[model samples]
Target: MIRVRVVTSRRLHVASLSTCTTPDSLLAYGSRILHCPDPHKKVALTFECQNRWKSEALPVYTGSLWGSDEAPGLPARGPRPELLAPKKMPSMKQLQTQASIPVIMLHALAHIELGAIDNYWDTLVRFDPVKFQLPRDFYDDFLTVAGDEARHFQMVDNRLRELGSEYGALPATRALLEHAANTAADLAARIAIVPLVQEARGLDSGDRLVHRMKSMGDKESAKVVEQIVWEERNHVRCGMKWFQHLAKVQKREQDQVAYFQELVLQFFPDGLPGPFDVEARQEANMGTEWYESLESKVAHPSGVKLEKRGDTQSASVAAFAASKKKVILAGSVWPERTSSAAGVRSADIIQVLQERGYQVLCVSPSRLNDHTSKLQEEQGVRCIQADANTDIFQKLLLETMPQLVVFDRFIAEEMYGWQAKKYSPEALRVLDLQDVHFIRRAREFAVKKQGLNFKETLDGEQLDIDPVEKIAIRELASIHRSDLTLYVSDFERDLLVSRFQVPDMNLHRCDFFYPAIDVSKLNSFNDRRHIAFIGSFKHSPNVDAVEWAKKHIMPVYRNLGGDAEVHIYGSYGETKRFVKLNDPKQGFFMKGFAPDAHETLSQYRLSIAPLRFGAGIKGKIADSWFVGTPCVSTSIGAEGMSLDGLQWGGTIADTPDTFASEMLHLYNDEARWDVAHQAGVAACSARYDASRNGDSLMERLERTMVEKRELREKNWMGRILWSENYRATEYMSRYIHAKNDGVNNGVK
Candidate 1:
C-alpha cells in the first residue's frame, strides 16, 4: 500500500491505497490530482474525498522515490506539489495530437446532437397535434437524449484533457457539422439518419483507436476511451429507438427505407466504402434488414429511371436536374386568373413545375393585379411586373436566365420565349395554350344570329377572324419554335394538330388542376330553389352570358312563378347593367366579388353558365363542380372540358326556353338537383384531382425534357449549329452591353 498527499490551490487531501505501493503507483495516483479551478475556462476534471484520513494510519508515502518533496524553490507555505506525475503524463505535443480527433469529434457531435434535439422540440411545438398525434413522452425522450449527448460530450472532453489536449486546440474538419447544418429542416431525419447512420460509422474507428492506443502502451488513454465507446453505444441506441418509434407512429413502410437511401445517395452521391460499423448498429437495435434495405436503396433508388431528350444523352440528366440551390423563375402573370388566359395558363404550369423542383421566377405585365401580387408574396415566388417588350425585360431575363422558359400566350412571343431562345439558348422553352382565341371569337359572332349551330357559327366573321386567327397562328408557331408546348387537354392537343396544324411531336397535354377543395365543406341541398351565374364580369363571354340570360332566361323563370333568385357574382361588378341588375326588388341579386369562389358557389342551388363562346375548360363549370353545384351550360360553355355525352350535372341547351325550363326544373326539383350535384362532384374529383393531374403533368414534362436533351445529344451537328447561333447571340448581347456602358459613361 502507498500513502499520498494531493495538493490543490484551495485544499490538500490524503489518498491511502491498498495495492499501489511502487514509485510508479504513487506518481500515477498524483497524476489524478487537479488544480482547484480548471486551467482552461471551458471545462475541467476534479476529484474530492468526503472524509480526511490520518497520515500515520496510511501506508508509507513514496513521494521521495518519484520526485524530491523538499527540493529547491519550495513554497514557504508547504513542500512543492507535483502538477502532473511523469508516469501518467506523455509529451505535451504528442498527447495533444493524440487527443485532438476525439475532442473535436465530441464538440462537433454535441453541437450537432443538441441542435437536432432542439429542432425536434421546435417541430413538435409547431406540429398540429391532431394531424401528427405525437405522444406526451416524445418531447421527454428528446430531452433525455439531449442530456445523454451532453454527458457524452463532457466525458469525451475529459478524456481529451487527460491526453494533454483540450477542445478548440485541434484543427478539425467541419464536414460533419456542415452536413448537420445543411439538413436542419428535418430534425428526426438528422437524428435518425445522420448521427445514427453517419456518426455511428465512427464507432468502429473509435474502437480501433482504443485498441491501437492500448497496444502502444497508453493503457490510461485506452481506459478513458472505453467509457466513450460504452456511452456512444447508448447514444446511438437512443437515435435508433426514436427513429423506429417515428417510423411506427407515422406508419412509414419500407418506402421510408427507400427514401432514406435516396437521401443518402443525394448527400453522398460519390459513394465512399469502408469505415462502416455493423456491431454498433446491432448494439443500437438497428436490424440487419434495415441496413441491407438502406444499402440496396443507396445503390439503386426506386423509380429513378432517366429518359434522354435533346442533348441530354450527351450530358447526364444529373447535370440538368434542378439543384437544391436557389432557383430563378422568370415569366409573365403567375397565379392570376385574369381575362388573359395566358395568366392562368402560366400560373398553373409554374405552380406544378415549382412543386416538382423549379424555383419560379414570375414576371407579370403589371403588379396592380391583387391575385398575382398576393401569390408572389405569400408563396415565396419572385414576381417582376415589367414590360416584356422592353430592354428591361431582356435585362431581367438575362440576369436570371432560368433553366426553363414557360410562355403563357403569344402576346410575349417575340419578347419572352422567342427572344430568350434567340438570346439564351441554354434555357428550355415551353409554351402553354389556354385556348384557341380565333375559334372563341369566331363562335361568339356566329352564335348572335343562329339559335345553335356549332359548325355554321364561323361562316361570316372574316375580319374579326383575321386578327384573332393571326395571333393564334403566331402563338402556335411559337409553340413549334419552343422545346415543348403544354396544352390543357388532349382535346386541345387534337384540335391544335387538326385545326392549327401543330406537329404532334411538339405538343404535350397537361390538364388544368383546380385548387384543392374539401367536399365535406359543401352544403348538401335538400330542396333546390335558386339559379346562379358566376364569372369574372370583366370576361367578355361571361358578360355576354349574363346579358343573354337576363333577356332570354329571366322572363321564363319569372313566368314559371316559382321563388327562384338569379345571382350574378364576380370581380368588377361596377358595370351599369350589373348595377341595374342588383335591384333586390326584381328578384335579381348581383353579389359583387366573392372572397372565395368555392365558398360562395357552395351556397348556390344551381349554376347557370350561358357562355356565348369560350375555348378551353370553363372556370364557372369547374367551380360549380368543386362545390357540388349542378351546372347548366350551353355546348360552347362546356367546350374542351371532356364532359361530352357524360351527362353534365345540368343540361346543355342553346335555345332560351329550353335553357330557362331546365334551370327552373332543376332548381324546383330537389331529387333532380341532388343527383346532378353528386354527378358533378364525381366529374370534378375524377377529372381534376391534382394528385393525378400533377403526377401525369410532371411525368410528361420530364419525358419532354429528356427527349429534347437526347435529340440534341444524338445530333451533334445540330447542337454545334445551335451553339454557333448561341455564340452569335452572345456577341450581339456583348455589343449591346458595350453600347450601354459607353452611353452611361458618355463615351459616344
Candidate 2:
C-alpha cells in the first residue's frame, strides 16, 4: 500500500513556515537568500525555503506567479565581506605553514560554499524556468542544491570556529561571482561557468583538502571534508542534468560538448588545471571530455600535468588568467561560409589554431553579417570589427600581441598585413593563399583568350598563363612577404617553389579537413533521387560550371536517362542569368540557397562539377563524397582532392559527353556506386580528418614561429618586396582613408 503526495499551492505535508516569511513565489524566496548577509541566517533561510518548497508547494511562476506585479528587490544588507577582485587576490602557493592549516582550508571551503548557495538561487530567480520553457523539476533540483550548499557552509564555518576562527575572519575573493557576472546576460553561459566549471572544480579541491587533512593526523577534519566532497558530487550531478536539459531546450543537443568546451575557453582562456578525480567526476556525470581537453591546457603545458590545486585563488586565477598563446584571424568582414569555399577554408584555419592552444580573435573592417558571422557566440572565436587603416586595429594589435597573425587570403594580407607587421612585428605572418589567385586568374584568362566556352578543358596538360598580370605580380609579392605561406593544393605548392622560385621550406600544404563521414549511414544509391550540382554563384568557377553543365553535360545526361532532373543548388541564384535558366519543365530546376548542403546532396544520385579550370580543392566534389553521393568531375575539377592515387571517389572525365556518360554508369550500378562511396569516405578520412590536419598545422605553425626571423633573413627578395611593396600599400590605404574622411567631413 503506497500513498502519493501531489505538489500544489495549498500544501503537500501540511507543515509550513510563517506565511509572511515564506513567499508563494520561488523568485521572492531567491531574493531573500541572495540579499541575506548573515551567513547563519542565510543557511536558516535556505533550509526553510527547501522545506516550504517540499511541503507547501510554492507556485513555480508561469509568468511571475505573483501575477505580473514587479518582483521584489533583494533585501539590502549593512555590509558585505571585504570582497577581493580576481587580480587583488593573494596566492596560496604555500600550502603548509606554521599557522593552523585547517582554519585556512576551512575558510576557503566556507567562501566556496557561500558562493555555491548564491549560484543556485540566483540561477532560479534570474533564469525563470517558465520563461526558458524549463521543467518545473528544474526549480526543485536547484532548491535541493541550495539546501546542500547552505549546509556545507554551516559545516565549514563550524569547523573554522572550532579552530578559533569564524567565517569572514579574513579577506576573500569572489572570482566565481565575477566570472558569473560576465555571463549574467546569458543563462547557458552562466550555467557552464558556475556549476559545470567552478563547482565541479570544487570537487577536485575537496579531494585534495581531504587528503591534506588526513595527512596532518586530523581524521575528524578529513571526515568533514569528505562529507562536503560527497554532497558536492551530487550537486555537480544536478548541474550536469539541468545543463543537458537546457541544451536540449536551447537546441544545442548535438553541439553540447563542443559548445561547453568553447564557453570554458571564452570565460577562462588559460586552461583549467586538474589532477581531476576521475571517479568522483564520472559519478557526477561530468565526463573527461568536459575537463580533460582543458586540463592539458594551462597548468599542463608541454603535456605535463599539474598535480595540485595549491589554494583557491592561485589555482583559479592561474587557470583563469589570459596566459594562453593567442592568434588573430583576419580576412573578409567575417567568414561568409555560404558565399564560397574561401569562407569554409578560413573557418577551418581558426579550428586548427585553436587546437594548437591559441586563443583566436577574428577581426575584420566590415560590419557583421555583410559576410556570414560564424556564430562567434558558441565557438569562442572573438569577432571584433576593426579596420586596418585605423587606430582601432593598432590598439587591438598592442592589446592582443598575437603570436600568430594569419591573413585569410593574400588579399586580407594586402589589406591588414602591413598594419600587423608595423605593430606586432614579432608575430608570425602566415599567408593562407587559399588558392593562388594568380593561377586561377591565369587559367580564366587563357580559357577566355582561346575563344572556348568557359567550361572547355585546355587541349594540353601543360598549363600556360601570362605571368605579368597585376593580380599575379601582387600575389607573388604577397607570397614572398609572409613568414610562411599555406597552400591548399600540392600542384600549387610545388608551382610556387619550382616555377615562381619561392622556397619549399617557406611554404606548407594545408588542405581542408573533414571528419570521415560513414558511407553506410548515408542514404543508399536506390534511396537517392536526382542529379544535382551545388556551388555559390558568387564564384565565377561555379557560374562557369553551371553554364557548361546546362550547355553540354545535362543535355547528354537527360538524353540517356529517360527519367532524371538536374537541380541546381547555390547562393546568389537570383542573378538574372541563373533566374532566366530556371526551366523546370525541361528538368532543370534552380534551388536558390540550400541551408544544408549535405542534406541537399544526399537526395541526389550523382553530382556534376563541370569545372574546366579552378584552383584549390573543389568543395562540390568534396560535398558529394562527404554524403556518399558520388560525383562526376573533370581532371582540373578533381585536382589535389585525391582519395587514393588520382581517384576522386567518383569518375573524372575531361569532355562534356564523357563526364555525363561516367556519372550515368556509376548511378546505374549499385556495386560501382558503393565502391565510389567507400572511396570518398576513405579520401575524407585520409585527406580531411581534422585531428590529423589540425595537429599537423599546429606543429607546422609552431615550427614556423621558431624559424620566422631566420626564414625572413634567408629571403632577401621577400625582405625587399615587404620593405618596398607593403610600405607603398600602407601609404595608399592611408591616402584612401584620409580622402574618405575628408569627403565625409566636407573638406573637398
Candidate 3:
C-alpha cells in the first residue's frame, strides 16, 4: 500500500524522525520525504535525497528484509488542508465562476505536485534494485522526476500565496494517492498505472489548463502551468522507458504491450479519451499503437458480452443466428434518424435488410444517444455500441454468423473490414459510399482556401495536394476491397469508374427502400406558403449553406420583391450563428429540428440551398421533393439528383443574383410552380420507389453472396490489402484479449 494522504503541519527535523529505520540509505531519504508533514520540507528533502545519491553518501539497498516499515506506504500528514474523497473535491466548472478561481486552481495543482513528489519517492523506497536486477539510472531517473515534482509544487504554492491565498486554502482529493496504493505491490503495474496513465493524463489536462489561463489573460500563471506540462513529458517518457526495461528484465519484452494493456484496463477501464495532445505525447514516447487498443471502450453496448452462456445454447443465441440469414451493419456513428439524413439512410438500410428476411444488427463505435437507444430498444433492430478491432465484436461475429456484412461508410470499412474477414471469411463484404466522403472534403478545402466553386474545384489539381487526397486513397482502397459497394448516386459511381478505374461490376447503385412522398397525400402548390431551406445543421454543407443564404442569397431575394417569407428547418440547429441569423423582422426564421421532414417541408412553396461546397446529392433537395416543395439549389446541391433532359423540381442557380431571380419567378408564377411541384413528387417517387429499388438492392446483395468468392478472387488488390490490413488490426485486437491468453503469448 504505497498510499499518500497528507495534511499540512510544521516541518520536521531529520534527526528527530524515527520512521526510516535505516536513516543513511537512498531508501531511507526517499521514505523520509513521504513522512514529512510540510510540503516545502518534502520538496527540500527530495533535492537533498537526489544530491546525497549523486555524492555516494546514500547507497541503493539490495533487499528489504531488514525493514517493511521503511516504506509504510501511509505517508505522514498534518491538519490544515482537509483531505476529501474524489467526489467531494471542487470541480473545474465550479472553480471557474469564483473570484477565488486562481487560488483554488493553484492550490489544487500544488496538491497534485505534492502527491507526485511522494509517489516518486515511494517508488524509490518500495522496490529493491538488486532483487529486480535494475540499473542505477532506474533510481537516478525517478530521483530526477521526484525533484521536478518538488519544484513544481513550490512554483504552484508561490503562485497561490501571491493570489491572496495559501496552499491550505482549498481541500484536496486522495484519488492520486489511491491510484498508487492500488498498484503498490506490482512494480510493473504501478509504473504503468501511475506514470503512463495518470501522468500522461495530467500532461493532456495541463495543456488545456495552460490555454485556459492564457485565454483568461493570466499569462504568468499560464507560463507556470506550461512549464510543468513541458517538464512532465519527460516524466511520462521515464515511465515508458522503465516499463519496457522492467518488462525486458522480467523476460516479458515480447508481451510488453499486452501486459501494459491488461494493467491499464484492470485499473482504469473507461479509457483515456484524450482530445489527445499528440505532439507532446509523441515527444514523450507515449505514442504507441497499443495505447489506443489498451484504452479502447470495447465492451458490448449492453455491457453483458462477458457473461457466461448456459451449457445448452441459449434460445436467444440460437434464434439470433438460427435462420442462417443475418447481416451486420457497422458505422462510426450510431443512427439517429431525427438528426441527420445519414441517420435516415442508416435506418433505411437496416429496414431494407430486415424486410429481405435477414436478421439485422448494427455495430458502431459511438455512444448510445436518445435516438439510437430508442431504435435499439423499440425498433427491433439491435444496435451494439462496439469498436471494430475487439474480441467482443469478434465473438459477436462468430455468434451471429452474418451472411452479409455491410459497412455504411468507407471509414467503417477501413476499421472493421479486415476483422470481419478474419472472423467470418464467407460473409459478403459491402462498402456503401454514401456519397463519396472525399468529394465533399476536397470541395470544402477548395472553397475555404481558394474560394473556388464545386465545378472549378473538380477540374483543378487541388486534390493532388489537399489533405483530403489522403482520405481519397483510403476511400478508393475500401471500394476495391469490397465484394460489392453501394452508391446512392449514378454520377458518383461513374466518376469513380472513369477517374479511378474502379470496376463497374463491383459497384451497385442501390437507392433502396427509403420513405418517399405518398403522391396522393402531398400538399398542392396552391396550398403551400413561404420559401424554405431544410437540412440537418450537423452536416457541414447545411451550416455553410445557411450562412451563405443569410449573408448573400436571402437579402437579395427580399430586395427582389420576393413576397414569401423564408423559413429554415433542420435538426440540431442550436448553433449560436444559427440563433443570430433568426431575425423575424428580416423575414428569416430558423424553424429548427423538424420532427417530420415531409410534413414540415410541405408547408413551403420552395426551398433554397445556396450550398457553396458539398459532395453528396443533397438530402435537403430530396426531402424538399418528397414534400412537393420546389427547391432552387446551387449546382453542387442539385448534383446527382438531376437528369440530362428531365426538369429539376425548381432550378439550379450557382450565383446570388441568378438564385434570387429563379426563386422569385417560381414563387410568383402559379402555373410554373405547379409544374415544378409535380416534378419534385415525380423525382422522389422515381428515385425511391420502394418496390423497385428495395427488391433490386436485396437481389444485388443475394447475388453478391453467391459470387463472393469469384468477385474477391478477381480483385487482386483486395487480397494484397487484406494481408497488410489484417496484420495491423489483428495485433490491435489481440491486446484486448491478451490477459485471457496469458501475458507471455504476445500478439499470438
Candidate 4:
C-alpha cells in the first residue's frame, strides 16, 4: 500500500510510488499528479511521472482510459502563493518602467510556469484519448513542454532569490489556467487556446521583456528570459503543427486563416493586444498578414465608438471641429520626440493642415507613447486609435464623413482607401507616396550589386523580381486611384508620370518642409568640430552608410591628419547590431539615438550622407542645412533636391576616395567650410523654407478637395482599381466583420 506523510510548505513527504503506484497508462499517471495535495508536490510528481513514462516504467495509453468520460475532474492542490483577481496583476509596461515591479513580474511569470506544467499534465489526462487519435509525437511534444516549463520555473525562481525576493513574496492570478480550462475536454480547442493563442502571446511580449531587462542593467536575468523566449518558439511551433494536423483531419485545410481566426475569436473575444513581436511569430509560422487580418476581424466587429480625449488642445479642437469641415489624416505613423525623417514630415504636414482650418484628426493604430501623447496634447491634433485594417476604421470614416482623407503611403491606401471611398465617397482620397518605393527598391538592388558599376545595372534596366514588381504595381495602382498623389521630390514626380505612366493630372509636387531656422540660435561654423551622421539605423541604407564610412572613409580621413571623428547618431532597434563596428582607434564612434536630431547636428561642423541608394530628399543632408552645417553626400543622397550645382551648400560625391577628399578639404580649409556652410543656408532657404513649402502643400490639399470629382474622372485607372478590385476586399472585410459580430453575440 502507498503511504502519504504529512507535508509542510517547505518540504515534500511522499512514499516511493514506483512499487505501489503502478500507473498503467498516461491518464493514470496524470490523475496521480493532478490530484497531488500540494502545489510543489504536484510539480514534483509531474516530473517524476514524466521521467518514469519516458523510461517506460509507466506505460503509454495505446487504446483508451477504461472510463475516460467518467474520469474525475482536475483536483485541488495545496496552495500558499495566494491567487488574486486579474485586476491585481501588474502590466508589462509598468513592470518595465519601475524597478520594484520586475520582481513582482518575475514572481508572476514563475506562477505562470507552474500553472503551465500543470496545464500540460491536465490536458493529457482529462481529454478522451481515442477521440483525438493523437500520434505518439503529440505526447512527446507535451511532455517536452512540461519539462521546459519546469526548468523555466527554476530559472525565474533562482532570479527572484538573486533579487532578495522569493516566489511567494507576491500574489499572482489564475488567469492562465482559467483560460486553459475553456477547452479542458476538447483537444483542438486546447491546442488553439493554449499554445497558438496563449504561448504565442508570450512570444509577442518576449523581446520587450528582454529589452527592458537589459535597459535595467540586469543582463544575467535578461539572458535567462531571452533563452526562454527562444525555446518557447518550439512550443508554439508544436501547437501550430498539431493544430494544422487536426484541421486537415477535419477538412478545414482550405480556410486555415479563417478557422484559426474563428477559434481565437471564440476564446478571446476582444482580440489580442499589440504591438506584437512580428519577428518571433513569423519564426513560429504565424505570419503577420494571417494574424493581423484576424486582429482586425475580432477587435472591431460591428463598429467602434470614437472617444475624443478631453484634454487641453484635443478638447479645443473637438469643440472647433464640431462646427468646421473635418479632414481625417489616417496613417499608422505617429510623431515622436526622437522621430524618423518620415515622422517629422508627417508632423509638419498635419500641423499645416490644422492651421489651414481643416480640423485634422490624425488616426493612428494605437496610442504610441508619452512622446506622441505629449505631441498631440501640444499640437491640438487629436489622434484616434482606429487601425485602418479594422471594421472600426470603416465606421470611423462613416461617422466622421470627412471632406478629405490622406493615406500616408501606398500600403496605408491599400489597407483603408477603399473603405474611405465606400463610406465617405465624397471625401477626396490623397495618396502621399513620400517618394516612390519601387524606385527606391530598384535603386537599392542596383546599389547592393555594387562590384559592378550601378550605372550599368540601374540605367534602363529592371530587377525582374517580385518585390520590385509588386511595389511597382501596387504603388502605381495607388497613384491611379487617388485624386492627388503627393511627391516630395520633383525627380520622383516626373519618374511616376514618365516611367510608370501615372497621369500627370493626378500628381502633385510638394517638397519636404524643413522647419524655419532661428538665425539667432544658430551654432557658428567656428564653434563646431567633428563630422556627424544622423539617420535612424533602423533604415537599411543608413546602416550601410555607417558600415561603409567606418571601413572606407574613416581610416583615410584620420590618416590624412584630420583629428575630428565621424560620430554616428540614430535611433537603434538593436544596438548590438552596430556595436561590433565601434572602434575608437579608427576615429569612428557609434552614438546611439539622439534626443534631438537637430540639436545634435548643430554641434557638428559637418555631416556625411554616403547613401548609395534611396529615394526622395535625404533628411541628413536637408536637416544638416537647417542646423547650420554642410554635408558631403553621394548623388543618391543629394538626389531630388536641385542642389546639384549649389555653391553654398553640400557637395555630392560617388566614390569613397572623392568623398574622403571632400571631407578633408572642408575640414582643413576654413574658407571652403564657410562657403559650403553658407551654401547649405542658401539651399535651406531655397528648397525647404517651411513658409513656402508648407503653404504650397496646404494650397494643393485645398485644391484637390475642391476639384476631387474632375480629378477622379480624368484618371480612368482610378475608377477601375476603386471599383473592380476594391469589390473583393470590401466584401471580404464585411464577411469577417459579420463573423466577428456573431462571435461576440454568441459568447456566454
Candidate 5:
C-alpha cells in the first residue's frame, strides 16, 4: 500500500509514516494543522508542510504495512471563520450590487479552497490503502492536488488581506465539506461528484467570474482566479483520470457517460444543476458529450427524448397534418363536475381550442373499462383512453398528430410527455401545473408539523422543505422537461423562478382562466344566511382548514353575536374522522357532499376558508364569487385569486377573531357586501371571462407552436434532457410494462 510520509526539518529526511497506522501521531505536524481551527494558521502550516515535502535531500523510508492502525477521520469544524447556514450567504446578484462584492466573493472562494485542502488530505489519510489497496500513484496524485489547493487558498487569502479583509472576517457555508462528508465511504463517488461534478462546475464558471472581476477593475484578483481556473482544470483532469482508472479496475466500460450519470443520480437528488463550462471540461478530458449527458440528467426535469427522423414520409405527413392545427391534451384523469375548478377550466379550454379551428383530443391514461365514454358524452369533448404503458398510446399520438400537446399536470407530463416527443417530435409540449404539487405538499407539511396557527404561511417566511427532497426532484424534472409550464398563481410562478431557480421564460401564468363565471346569472346578495366552507375533504389542507374554523373561528363568531350556523360542506365530512367535528347546536354542521355546489353555496351570504398552507389559487374563493357569496379567508386562501379584501368579494384574515369579525361584518352590512359582490362580478367579467382568457391561452399556444424550434433552442436544458436523459425513463417504463404483461399472461 502506498503511503504519504512526513519529511522532518532536523535530518532533511523523509520518515516512515503510515497515515492510518499511527493512532496518535499521523505525521504530528500535518495532523496538528488538520485539527487547527484558525483558517489563517491552518493554511500557513499546510504551506510549510508542502515546502518540506518538496525538499530534494528528503530520504525515503520503506516499512511493513501495519494491520492494526486506525485511519484519521475528518477534522472538527473550526471556531474561527464562522460557519453559517446556506441561507445566510447573500445571493450572487445581491453581492454584485454591493460595493465590495469582489472581495467578499474572493474570501468565500479562499474558504472553499481551504476546505478543499483539508478534504484531499483527509481522504489521503482516512482511506487506508491496506484495506482497499489503491495504487501508489493514487496517493501521489491526491497529495499533489492537496498541495495545489493550499497554494490556491494562499492566493485568495492574500488577495483578501490586500482588500483590507481576512478569510475569517466573513461567514462561509459548509457546502464544500458537506459534499466531502456525503461521499466519505465511497471512493468512486468522491471522485465523480467532487472533481467531475463539483470541480467541473468551477471550470464552467471560472471564465465568467474572471471576466466579471476584470470588469470590476480588480485585475490582480482576476489574474489570481484566472490562474486558479487553469490549474483547477488539472484537478478535474486528475479526478476524471482516477475515476476512469477505478472504473477499469472494477471491470466497468471505458469512457461510459451512462456510468457517470448513474453515479450523479446515486449521489444527487436533482441531477447536475447547470449552465456548464464546456471548454474547460474538454480541457480536463471530460468530453462535451459526457458533460451534456450529466447536464441532461440534472437540468432536465423530464428525461430528454431523441427525435427519430428516420422516416421522411412520416415527417412530411406530420408537417402537412400540423397545418390543420391539431392539439392533444393529456391528463391523469378526466375532470368531473361543472362546479369543479379543474373541470370548468378543462371545458373552457376545449371550447376555445375548437372555436379557434384546432382539432383537440383529450386523452387520459384510464383503463378501457373506466368512465371515459361517459365523460366524453357529458363534457361534449371527444375523450380517449390511451394507456401510457402500451404502444397504443404511441399509436394514438401518431394518428392524432398533434401540433401542440398539453400535459394536464406534472404527473401527466412524466407519464406521457416522452411519447409526445417520440411520436410527435414537432409538437409543442406544455405542462399545465395544476398548482405545483411539491409546493402544496411542502405547505401541508408545515401545517401538520407546526399546527394551523403557524405564522410562517401568512408572514411570507420562505417555506423550506415541508416537501421531502424526493418530491422536489420529481416536480423540478417535470418543469424542466416541458417546453413551458402554466401556473395558475403568480405567487407560485414567482416561487418557482426565485426559490426553485426555474428559468422565468419556461413559466406561463394565467390565473384568470380557471374562474370563469357568467356575471349576469349570479344571484344578488339578498336574503342569504349562515357562514359556509366547501372543499373536497380528501385534500389535507381542506380538512385542516375546517378543523381550524371549528376551533378558532366558531367560538369568536358565537361570542360576537353572530347567530348564523356555520355549514361545512365536502364529500368526506361524514367520514369516520370528521363526524366528530359536527355539532348542530353549536351552529357548526357538516353538510356532506352537495350534488350541486353552486346551488347549495348560492344560499349562503358569505364563505370562509381559513387555509393555513397550500399552493395555487383557491377554488373556494372563486366559487363564492361565482355564486355572489362574499368570502373571508386567510392570506393563504386568497393566494392566486388576485384579490385585495373587498376588491374581489373576499376579506383575508389570518387571526381567528379577525376571521370571525370579517365574516360577521360581510354577512350583516348590506352596503359592504354589495361592494364586494359587485367587485367579484367585475373580476369575473374582466379577468375570468372564459372567452377572453381562452383566446389569450389559444394565442399563446399558437405562438408557441409557430416558434417551436426557436423555443427549443432557447430552452437548451430541456432540449438536452429530452434528447439524452429521456431514453433511460423510456426503456425503464417499457421494461415495467413488459414485466406487468408477463405477470398478467401467466395469471390467465
Candidate 6:
C-alpha cells in the first residue's frame, strides 16, 4: 500500500510519497505519482482480507453484525463497507483546492525577485552606470528590491523543501522575468509592468490559494500564503510610488492612469487586461482615478523604427576638390621589385579610410588583369592596374581622375610622377618615404665589405651613395615634384629634412599603421615555448639575423642543456645554405612563409630579430609585439620603437656572447619572461590602437587638404612655371603612348 502527504515550509508547497518498498523503487514511483493531474494534500489507505478455515465459510459484516456464524453449510460473502471505500479519490477542483494560496503567491514573488537580481548584477558589471545618468536613488531602490527578493526566494525555497521536494523538482516559469530583462533599457516601464502589474495579479491569485488550502484542512500551508500576501502589498506600493513620481517630474499632465496605459500599449501590447486589485493597489498608494484611467487604454506594443542614410557622395567630392598635396614614399628594392612594405601601408590607409566612411581606390601592379578585377568583386574595393613606368599609366590616370595619388618610392619617375602632374594637376600627390634607400644600401655594402668605410661603396656609383642612393635620387626628385611626402619614422623624416635637404613644406611624418588582425585569437604567453626568428627571409637583414642566431645563439641553449627549439620563419624558400644551417639535429626548424605572421608568432616563447643592419621599421618586430611574444634584437633592429626604459622584451644584445646569455636567461627565468611578454603586449596595444593613431591620420588628411587648397591659390604663378617645365616631359610621354598604340594596332 502507498500513501502520499503534501507539506509546506517557509511558505513553499511540495508533495512527499512513502511505500513499503526499496528506497530507489519508492522514489521512482513517487516521482510518477506526484506528476499526476490530481492534486491532494494527503491520501492514506488500509487493506484487510480473511484467513481460510473450514469448507463452509461465514459472512463478514460491520456495525450490527459482529462475527456471523451461520450453520456450517452457509455460503460466504465478500469484505465490508470500510474496505470498499479504501480507494478514496478527489476531483480536479478538490485537488486544486488542496494547494496553499500563500505558497502560490510566493512563487510569483520569486519571479520578479529573480528578475531584479539578474538586472542588478548585469547593470553593475556589464553596463557601467558612470557612462549614463542612472541616479543614486535608482540604485538604492534596486538594492532594496534585491534584498527583499533574496528573502522571497529563500521563503519559497524553504516551503518547497518542507513539502518533501526541492525547488528544481517542479516545473517553473520565467516568463515575467524574461520580459523584464527584455525591457531593461527603460527602467520605469520595468517597475510599472513587472512589479506593479504582474505582481498585483499575484496578490489576487494568493487569496485563492489560501481559500483552497484552508478548505482541504492544510491550515499550516494556508498560513504561509497569508504571510506573502501581507508583504507583497508593500512591494506593489513601491512600484506605484515610483511610477507616479516619474509622471509628475516629467510633467505628464495626461492622467497618470492614462499615461501608464499608454506606456503599456507602447511597451507591452500583448499584456493581459485586468480587473485589478483595487484595494491592494490603493493600499500601495495608487489612486483609484489613476487605476481607472489605466484600464481604459488598450493597445499593443509596436516595433521601434530606425532610420537609414545613403552613401556620402558629397563628402567625397568635397575632399577631392579641396587641394593638391604631394606625398613621397621611398624604399622599394625587394625580390618582387614591388615593395611589400608599401603594399602593407596602402592596405592600412585604405582600411582606416573605410572605417571612417570614406570612398577609396587602390592601384597595384598585381591588379593589371583579371586578378585585380576578381579582387575588386570579392573585397568590394575599386582597384586599377597601371604601370608606374608607362605613358599609358598617365592616360589611365587622366581617365580615372582620382583626387589623391600616393607614390611609394620613385618606381617609375618618367611614368607616374611627371605624368600625374601633366594629366591630373588637381590631384593631391603624396610620397611615402619607406626608408632612406641610399643610406641603407651604403650601410649594407659597408657591412658586406667588413669595414666602416662608407665612401668605398659610393666611389664608383654614378648615383653618389650606393645601390640604394640611385633609387633615392629618383625618389627625392619625385618628392620635389609632389605636394606632400609621408615618412614612416621621425628618424626617416629628419634624415630627409636635415641630411637630404628636402624642403619642410613637402614633408609630413606619418608613422606606420600596424595591420589590424584578430588580437583576441592569440593565446596567452603561458602556452608558448621555443625561440622564434620571424621576418622576410629574402631581405638581407633578416637572412643575416637568422644565420647569426643559428651560429651564435643555438649553441648556448645546447650548452645550457635546456629544451628550447629555434624556429626560423618568414616568406622565402630554404636555399642550400639555409638548409645546411637549419639541421634538425641542432633543434633548428625552418618554417617558410607565414601568411598570418602574428598567428604563427603567438606560439613561440620568444622572438629574435638580431638584424645586423636595416633601414626603416621592421614589420617582424612589430608583429612579435602584437602577439605579446617578447623579442631579442640589436639596437638597430629596435630603433624607432620609442619603447623607453621598457625591458627590450628580452635584450638588445649586439654581441654573440651577450645575445646567447640574454637568450638563456629569458628562456630559463619564468618571472623575467612573463614581465617581458606583458610589456610587449601592452606596448603594441597602446601604440597601435586604431582609435588613437587612426584619428590623428584623419585629422592630418583633413589639414593637408585645406593647406593644399591654400597653396594652389597662393602659387598660381608656380603652377604656370611648373606647367611650362612639364611640357617637355608631357611630349615625351605622349610620343611613347602613341608608339605603343601603333605597335599594338600593327600586330593586330
Relative to the true structure, how large is the alpha-carbon lDDT of every model?
Answer: 0.54, 0.71, 0.74, 0.71, 0.69, 0.53
Tens-digit lDDT track of model 4 for 1-748? 6655444453233332343566666665666665665656656666776787788646555232333331235445456566667898667665455437668768878887777777787776566545666777777878878777877888888888899886776656756557556776567788888888778889877766776777678877776777677678878888888888878877887886678888888877667666555546655756544566555333333355434344664554445457467877766455553567787787777777777776777766544445456666788666666554456677666666788888887766766778888888998889887777777776666668534443443343343335367457767887888888888887777667766778887877766677667777888768998999988765668878888888888777777777888888876523334777878887788887688888899999989998866788777788888888989988777777755566647677777788898898887788888888888888888888878887888788788778887877777787887776555455655655565556555532
Give the higher-lDDT candidate: 5 or 6.
5
Ranking by TM-score: 4, 3, 5, 2, 1, 6
Q: Alpha carbon lDDT of residue 238, candidate 3?
A: 96
Kindly report which residue stretches of model 5 are placed more than 4 angstroms away from their true locations once superposed.
1-323, 368-371, 458-461, 512-522, 643-646, 723-728, 738-748
* Estimated TM-score for each candidate: 0.50, 0.55, 0.63, 0.67, 0.55, 0.50
lDDT of 6 by residue, 1-748 (tens): 5554333332112223343432222112223222222211101110010111012231211122211111111111112101112134333354346444443444444444444444332332222233333444544454444445445555555665676543333223434335535545555566666666666766646655666667667665665555556566666766776676667655664576677777776765534344344435544555334433233213223442222112442242344334243222211211121224545655566566667766555443322333334434544445444433344355555555666666655443323566666677766777666665555655665666455532333222222354445355555665666677766666566666776676676676565575454557666656888988877644667777787778877787688675788888765434434656767988898876577676788898888877766667777777788777888877667766655665555567767677777777887778898888777766666566666677887776667766887765554433553575644444554554454344334422
